[model samples]
Target: MTMSKTRSEGSLPVVSLPLPVDVTAPAVARQAVRATLGGLGLDGPEVDDVLLATSELVTNAFEHGEKPDRLEVEYSDGRLTLRVFDSGTSRPKLKEPSPMAARSRGLQLVHALSDDWGHELCSGGKYVWAVFSLARADASA
Candidate 1:
């Protein structure tokens, strides 16, 4: 796997990687996000939330979406954005799984953890993105 970083004057750094479309995708994504967030000097519950959400996104792509392409993690202005790209036509939905259900709560967890989340259709497929506020004060309130 190859990782790239981009930064400009007054712009925050972005770390992106092309993910493998298999069981290892989630683990790979979590590792990348953990290192990236740590390097940015961020920790605490907010960072944990980001890591969990990144895993869910990557897992969804590997299971439901087609040709999971890339994962991007970006931190800017006290906010963190995680996006997963896939060459799939169907979009992710937030569903309320039954309490006894064995699965299908990934998006639900994402919605609860993230300040805002959505998906957008791109040229070949779509990308689902989740945004989190890294400010501890905001999270408490």
Candidate 2:
């Protein structure tokens, strides 16, 4: 698989989920992200990276955003976007990776894996999103 640099321009491709606020809901977020990327035709290590990043960001939302059931995803044009919306007003941020700490790696991981990610304010709260490039789907001979 090839990892290319992101161009300046892009479009939105997201799957928004309004889930009940649960605590550290990684499994559900994993399923949602996997399904979204699966539908978008991505596979292999890229798929795993996308899923891992999604899980981390979703966990951060629950831990910091304090909103669980508001997770959502958007996939389009070779991009699988993961968004976790919460009632909290705080925005998501990436901190320097610390090797001595036992935790505090969610945003670090998300920043490492995704091509680009950010947060946006919604009507009721805020949404944190991570977007990864879709791997080229192999065609049947």
Candidate 3:
């Protein structure tokens, strides 16, 4: 995602991050998000929540979704959006893993935190996203 486009009226300010999908990229991206949102006066817990949510989603993209060149995070006025790209449109599901499975917490965690989340099939790949309300974040801050 890029910053050149402005969101439509009453739509949401849109900030985009076009970064490589690498091991350290997600962590770095999370930090960038924190810096950006925190500047708007969001408190610690809210920032942490969004950070955790993004971390979970990015981890899933790295683990399951194809490692596309970039991860698009669209941050507007009242909502934060996450868009991760992959080669194909794969609808990921939360499977009840063996009760002891060590690596299936991604979607579960995301479902618990994000207000809403889903996927979109694009011309060449897919974008999985989640939106969190800033109002709740501000109130909790």
lDDT of each: 0.87, 0.70, 0.69
Prediction 1 global C-alpha lDDT: 0.87
Clash count of each predicted structure: 0, 10, 1
Residue range 11-77, candidate 1, lDDT tens digits: 6578889998789999999999988887777788788889999999999998899889999888777
Q: Is candidate 1 or candidate 2 better by TM-score?
A: 1
TM-score per candidate, chains pooled: 0.90, 0.78, 0.79
**How would you encode candidate 3's per-residue C-alpha lDDT over 29-125 as one tens digit per residue?**
6876776576655555666778888788777777787765455556556676777666666888976667788889888888888888888888777
TM-score of 3: 0.79
lDDT (Cα) of model 2: 0.70
Please provide the root mean square deviation of candidate 1 (C-alpha atoms, Å).
Answer: 3.3
State the number of backbone clashes in model 1. Answer: 0
Where does model 2 exceed 4 Å of error? 1-14, 136-141
- Top lDDT hit: 1
Full candidate order by TM-score, most accurate first: 1, 3, 2
